[model samples]
Target: MRGSPAGASFSAAAYLADVFKLKLADLHEGLVEADIKEWLVAEGDEVGEFEDLCFVMTDKASTEISSPVDGKVLKIYHPEGSTAKVGEVLVDIETDGPVAGSEAEAAPAAEPESAPEPAAAAAPAGGAGGEYDEQMITNAAGKSRRVPATPAVRGLARKHKIDLSQVAGNGKDGRVLKGDILKFIESGGAEGGLAPAAPQAPAGGAARAPAAVVPGESRTEKVAPVTKAMIRVMEEANAIPHFGYSDEITLNSLIETRLRLKPVAEAQGIKLTMMPLFIKAASMALTEYPILNSSLSGDKSEITYHGSHNICVAMDTPDGLTVPSIKSVEQLSILDIAAELNRLQELGAAGRLSRGDLEGGTFSLSNVGNIGGTYLSPVIIPGQVAIGAIGALRTLPRFDAEGNVIPAKVINVSWSGDHRIIDGATMARFSNVWKNYLENPDTMILNLK
Candidate 1:
């Protein structure tokens, strides 16, 4: 086979092998399929090991796959923009490098490890930690539990109001991925195992025909990818049972403190804003009210109190609205948070935010105050539980110590929490604590980490 010089392994001892089949690597592990955005190397082009040979795009992100061996691109199995399954033979190369053990390039090994029989329980993968552990949350029943699911799965459960714990995981490592919950729903299990929902007819008990568009009345345009992403998430977030609480914090002290520090911060190349203060206040509040800093699991039995205060800052960009996070806010100073917030904004503007930047948030701030929103009820970012919006700062009349009317700076703020774990009273109390840190900057200043 090696002497054939046609589609044979390169390990011909003395003779150079003619070809090597390039199988797709697990670059993005959770992703099942990706569209090849472009192929950087053409047939007959020489390529080196670790050189980016192609680009692939998934819904979450786009990744560049590199060549493993120096080679000449001989045949491209998949074209640009074509979908390819993971581990499939994406391309074939001609190289002097050693080739596979056999001629069947894409076929499995002769003695492939036998797969475990499908169990009632989910399959086990490597322990959920690092990336997988991002979704591994603790249940609220005082039990430390890790649900092996993806972010999309958790988002779906949130949308359908299904309890993941009730739905047995069948994915890798008992991972309760999106398909698991979907399968559970298909199996007549929602809240209770096998308790199905009765089918309901449309209003008026009639099947309606699809509505027709009037001629010359409307024009249709393809949905932009960024907007499409926003649509999916906003629809899911709106579907959740939303309950909100409103509160206000006099911005006088916070404003003064920031104004005083602005010059000092500017000298250090930091354009400090009120956002860092709000983030800092929220982080402090989370320490006192851990529930507000948590995202609820699919099952009502648990609220995963996050160990880190990764607070997301929602920003409006020309592309769309993006909320990237500054991780571990509890450990950051107001200045450090401000720096990270600026860095994240730069990344968002440049369209360089990785999926990691857009996820793993324990809490978030919708700082509409920058754009003149007095108070807007922000929809929770899917997967995470709570979000708060800050209103624009305004001057209001207030009584001074001597009973004289005085102008004071204030901003209205509001909280929208998951009613399951965070109650109205809880929101109120948490808001008060959050406001205390802002109104009394000294409290935050004295306790600054």
Candidate 2:
């Protein structure tokens, strides 16, 4: 019943539940999503408190989620190979008794045999008063935060002009039940009683993203063969130790250089583009910072500094995301690189790339510029040391040394590197070199000749 008491009258011996959700492990701090590798325990399997239940794959790494109670798994909301947002329910463990020293308050004593069907793990889409009615919101920081409560509870809340997130939950796992909302309104809410948005931080650290509370819905989809392959590759890449850095670089000189060369290259029936320019500059920087063009062994015991700069460019194709590298970028001139890129892009668009086109990549570049993205954290392919995300190039007004406001073509580049070997300063130094060549292509042009 919507807005009903915590434990409504039901048959005795009803089994209560302790829900376990996929959350960010200590090792995975910035990750917001993960995929269910597989369910270790199948539905109907009995489990103990704090027991390993399933493996989840994240961009950061893979980890196992443990059960929080001693009970039989009553339901499995999410199946294998499905993506789940952080804080989404992974499993529901039904227990005859309360969890060992659980912090969650029991919804009064109910009929033990009347074991209510586990509350739908997620809010139904637009089902106001359905089995699982909840309203979802994405905060200013672009994160989906779900507020858990039934329709009537939410209506009562709106009538009193209350923000549900501010109200504390007294039901199972601190869920804000209808009664909790009424109690909050009865306590003179909004007058002096709204909880702040940002959760309190530790004694000496910056506040972390608020712990997600709502269990997100999990939908299953049949992936194509290419998508399956891509998923496997991406999951393998997820184990890499990733660290991100971003910088705004001016592209005025590069833009001018390209404008002059565009006609020269077009005369030969070749379409010169900015991507080849990025690859060229990145290759130059990789020559000096060889680690950026290197690969680590499976155990990370050794690093192989590749001499041939095979710069792979990530592209989205109808089949899936494909990365085709231009072989020996260091040996090719910018024009030659551009022609190769054009060939690969056409092949990608036509879905005709060969295995060779997708292999032997030492480094990667992702251009979100075409899509008008200012910056992105591009995923580094497994084995490669680094990948850079190219932002949209824009002419923004910037103040000069003389305090004169002048228009400057700027681009934001975001780099993610293997933190285990390439430290932040090293990545920053390499980025600075790459940015130098792009910002002043004349220096790179001298090397080309």
Candidate 3:
């Protein structure tokens, strides 16, 4: 064999010591793949350990993905708007040596706070919690730093020529929230002769922009990720045979109970709503009829009876509809459930819910009453066997035991169940049990652990 000469073209790649394949790991349960929303870095860019490389949008939530090593990105396997599956390589990087960042970064973002009771354990990922703070990065120059802010906030800052670093952050972990930037600009906080933001017209007198209209004009648009996922889930849900059950229940006792508890909850900085009460009663009812909290496997050969009552509540958010579940509602007190509900609702409104908050739902409840719906045929989520929709409370005259007419507070309830798993009789019985808990708050209180 002849020795290879310098001009013979020995591959330089052979001399490269460490090439790291950054595979997409399991960020949360049931996360098969994530749509890459945007890439923060490009090929040949050097990334610091734990620096975010991209943001991914799953069916229920969006999260940032970080690099696990101090390395230079050799190639990006998935571009923005591409779907990458779990265990698939996301990027290839040339690293210096063994990196310790992978293990810590792969785990799901920890909840900011813990629930008081063990059952109401899942916490919401909201605001500028530690998760967003971790995304703050140092620039390539290693002198300037990137502040943690949403794209909208950054754009607003750019439009005003305001430096985000100079703005004070009041969000969790000192992340620069959009409101903070607005306040900074409004207070004339910009330095170095940057132009102030344009003044707004007086509140009630501001002129509205005229709506533009063009006959026979149309444009095509892609569905948003959240909306697309919801459509896909609904289509899959439509495959299951469904049956509806309806009833009207007196909510007078439940109303009184809430009125009594309102002051207590308010004193403790929690908003007392009927949702926590509904969730509590449903969880209690689930104990007697576990089938309602069960699911059928894909092949329909096996049934899974979940131990905990992970009840999901459908939320109508600014982006779209989201159903984030409250974990183990069975073990939580009404107050505890109220706290968890508050946490989830806030996060859901801001579109900051974690996958953990959205997964492991065994049953669902949708309160259309808040939005003025009288009744709804709520759809069952794919994995869950049943769902309930509640209508607005209305007062109606009913005959008393003495044959005298009396005004009663009532609400319409509609139930949708997987016909394959739940029969009409079982559904009726479950509804009665749940209704009993609400009609008599004392019963629910006595049964509470």
Candidate 4:
């Protein structure tokens, strides 16, 4: 109104801006609630379209919510460290135009009839305090570790000149809580007194002294939402009857091929790894044996074969085990697959993968070999008919066709299939096809389209 055009009669209603309510929708499939990790803006602050307003940590990933319109922050419905259910209003912004999702006013928050069952007890963000310390410090090894505690707790510990790392944590995942810090100070910093232990005498031997407690004393931990989701997934997966197969695959040819093409990939700024090769080979095999990519219905009377090879790769992050998938592996070349894998790995490491990244997985693979595991009997994820685990590579001597000893690089590949549908013969045939592709890269390349 202050800057209205010279002959324009501005009505008060026309000049007034509409308030838009920013609600939290489903970030990922199966996500019911999310922890408001932090807020980047406050009420009365000016926000531009697409600007990040809040950071939310869901069971699957940590994501940033953005403002949809240019506006002033009218209100923040939920504070950081609080949980909000799907469809709940997160914030309100006053905008110039009528926003599509704008509501007249915020809806009353819904309250559950009863308290929801505690999710697999993870450390409650902020715990009994609000605002957490997100600063990361480099450890002696140059790796960064995020200290899980509120700013208040950190301040209290600092005021007392206490080293937080040495304080025994009684919170979830052994997070240092304010109460634990107080107890440590009250106990003269002696680990709040060690646990009592009774000595026992071995048969015909002198009484043995009890082992001393470690620097950080033992304490029970509450499971956070991520761990809770993991627990639920594992519990559901356990109900599926499973049968397994394991074999050592010779990977010399694959390794040679990778070495030859490494520079080509580097030129394109892609870090090519064995996983892309494995995933591509598996996808090709699934094309031939679609049954392996099928899912058994809840009633066990129907089997639905998925068209896309959305293969999931298990990743171990700070939050816990997460299996995010690369969509449509059958449609991507080895290099394309490598690029997608690299993207997923980076996002997974940063805990920023979205629901689309995690959902629609038709087959699963776990490359435990990267972390130094030799053999693994990985449990099959629910919904998928099978999952595979690859073990560490080892050089072993073997006899060639001429009976001469040759050093061969081999890795153990293990598969677990739903016993109800996938028989041993079918699984073996499928594995053989996947193995042949890896063993003979030239043939695999010919088959690639």
Candidate 5:
């Protein structure tokens, strides 16, 4: 049987010879359900145990599956997008020799008294301290830990394509956690080595590295690559169905209410914003029409309702738009909401928002109106059922009950709902409730109880 290489895929024959007692002939097959990110080895190539065979796509992300043994590639069960479920053959490897039983007779047997040694132990390795040491460290820590960080941390580093080992660890047992990794990543890691050293000066008291000069070259231009998050967000937005709705809201009284609350907010060192007011109004509306605060299942089997009102606030960043949610907005007062929103917005702009900030939002609000837009039909975020777009406030003439034309501060509020879950009447009711709350801002502030 062939020996499997570390980080490469192998056949069942290789597993039996190097790692396990079971033969390739005994194992079942499976199919590939999604696109492969990349193949670890080419076709007709030999693979060893524990090598990454290929990466398969899941709904949220892609995962790499390893080979169980070392063997030659005989067949690939399915092309990309083919359904791979239980008991399906994936790839077949040419076995070195015949096993003890016929193919048809190979069935379930009694459990062995002891499990076989891991195939990684027998594979030839490569790297800094020899392949064996790398394998030992990798296997002992598991791929993620051995890789020295979480996918998020690694992705952040990779956005800059920075190395993890070069960063100092500040986590448990000197292990690198997300925060430590991020700090190092943001600072571009160590200067010359793992530890800081005394500064050295050049002959003429210069401390900077000598700049290189290219003959006849005038200038150099550098371009940064896009981040994975940015790619995923754009793809998801483009691929998903996004519907929008807009309504003009009279914010004259809402603005007045903020003025009244200003003194109190200032006393508490909290700057007031319209966001918390919107959040309050939206939360009230969602309580009356719960379906608007839900998510559609991919299969459309059912709408998942959320008990908490985690309102996602869309903020503009240098990279792109990011929505960091204020969890349980229903439980927060106007002042509390304002403070939290301020902190979240700051963290978001700084590119320091945690994963928790970016996920599990029951609803979202995008206030492009702050930037001078009168109205916009905000796109419904994929996986989320609804998103509201708040537009700029403008003084528009309106007719009163007595037919008198009066100037009113009108703000456009657009609610984009998932057609799969919310109906026209439901959406209209939600909007009306929200509009009522905003127009009567006194009700929200006075009725905080």
Candidate 6:
């Protein structure tokens, strides 16, 4: 059977008849690459159904493929450097009982080798053993054998020109692992018998050597590296016409209300903050203006409306930026949103967010204000109609109904919407509703239910 969508939970196929052998399934189609993140079970180790077998890189993100049946791994297909294409066998697994599935037909095994004549051995390389030895030497023992290492370990060795034979392998059966190579490199064991020497100032001169300069006639063009996610986001945003709306919200009442709820939240062992309030307000605003919660199809032929408010919270990870969704934000209370937000943030920062956490977002919220930005026009995430940016709250003087100026905590909210689905008037109306809810914290609490 084919693999399911990236986020959906999937199980392996059932057992088949005749105790057929199970093969390692390829997760993606490409050149076979070996950089297995985890081995579900070791050699002769038994694994249950739906167990995580291994994670492999697919020129994209690392993905985990699960075991299709309960079995023991018989053999690994590639010995680290070998690459395989999609649907190619990865490993051999031995099943206990009858194997499941119609794909259990036995394949023909290799023909038995015949004995070679003594005269053939005298003549250079005429026997079956001669051919096998030649092929093994060429394919396995040539230049590649000198670097019998895992992909990550080989990468480190090449980066520093380290000889694998010089580094001790701590992996199973003396195989070189990344950590072993790294430790060797760090301790200078792989430095070609030369102790790293410190550089001295230029001989007979107080100043350092002159800096190198490029030729004047040579023209150099600067190009920035863009990630896959960034490319998709920019392509969608530029291709789609966007309508933006900005509004300033008075945060004075909101701040006071949070302060009042703080003690109660603390007593209940929950933290009360502006984020939960903002999420609640945004959820309410989404209900009032459901059009803002919909996305435009690529052909502009249809608009897709989502029933649940899967709000994507923009988070910064060590790898890059990631937006993990808080499923059903509309159903969560202020305290519940706070707890979920904290949990998601923690998962996102640790780079432990699963595929489900990153998919199916109907709307996104980016709190750039946390980094000191007062306002920002965030790019619209692909497949999502709108993205809201929250700015830092600051004290600003504003006139009240009495026409008297007073200091208030003012926050900036910027919304970028797909013009194909949401018009300027509709976006402005949505922003107005958000502003109203945020300004009146009491209304936010009432509407949250």
- Candidate 3 weakest ten by summed lDDT: 4-13
- Give candidate 2's error at residue 58 in angstroms: 24
Question: Across residues 81-127, which tens digit of lDDT does each residue of candidate 1 receive?
Answer: 57777667777777765664443222111111121111111111111
Error of 1 at 213 (Å): 17
Model 1: lDDT to the true structure: 0.62
lDDT of 4 at 262: 73
TM-score of 4: 0.67
Which candidate tops TM-score?
A: 4
Q: Please identify model 5 stretches exceeding 4 Å from their true place.
A: 1-230, 238-240, 446-449
- Clashing residue pairs in all predictions, respectively, total 8, 11, 0, 6, 15, 8
Q: Report, for every candidate in turn, its global Cα lDDT versus the true structure.
A: 0.62, 0.62, 0.70, 0.67, 0.55, 0.57
Candidate order by TM-score, highest to lowest?
4, 3, 1, 6, 2, 5
Best by lDDT: 3
- Displacement of residue 262 (Cα, Å) in model 3 is 1.3
TM-score to true structure, per model: 0.60, 0.51, 0.65, 0.67, 0.51, 0.57
Clashing pairs in model 4, backbone N/Cα/C closer than 3 A = 121-222, 121-223, 121-224, 122-223, 122-224, 172-222
Ranking by lDDT: 3, 4, 2, 1, 6, 5
Stretch of 10 with least lDDT, candidate 1: 108-117
Clashing residue pairs in candidate 3 (N, C-alpha, C atoms within 3 angstroms):
none
